[model samples]
Target: MPCIRDLRIPVSTILGQLATGRAAGEILEDFPDLEPDDILAALEYAAAAVQERELPLAAR
Candidate 1:
């Protein structure tokens, strides 16, 4: 799997894909070796990462 080829690509990229409207089915189709759970975990990680950033609305 391409994912296995590079373990350091943070999960944020995956979350970005979803946020930009890439569905799970499409992601899976594009990267066949990724399981459904991997996508879910990436989402969870992204959520946590955002919380950690904790930027105020004023910053945006």
Candidate 2:
């Protein structure tokens, strides 16, 4: 599978950090190998993937 920006860091790892309410700065600070743009790219990749899925809507 393709990793993030040619690094071994997977996008899932970045997403997990965001999911746990970790701030972008915190993630970057904790993971010196990552960049601010890496977080943004991971989010964008996740958003695109979600858009391709079929989600159930609430009852109107």
Clashing pairs in 2: none
Give the distance in Å from residue 47's predicted Cα in candidate 1 to where it truly belongs. Answer: 1.3
The candidate scoring highest on lDDT is: 2
Q: How far out, in Å, is residue 47 in model 2? A: 0.5
RMSD of each candidate relative to the true structure: 6.7, 5.6
**Most accurate candidate by TM-score:** 2
Error of 2 at 40 (Å): 0.2
Q: Please count the clashing residue pairs in each candidate, in the order shown.
A: 0, 0
Off by over 4 Å in 2: 52-60
What does candidate 1's lDDT look like per residue over 1-60, in tens digits?
123225554576677778899999998787777778888888766576568555567754
Q: Which ten residues in a row have the lowest lDDT in candidate 1?
A: 1-10
Model 1 misplacement above 4 A: 1-9, 52-60
lDDT per residue as tens, model 2, 1-60? 546897888889989989999999999998898889999999999898878667799998
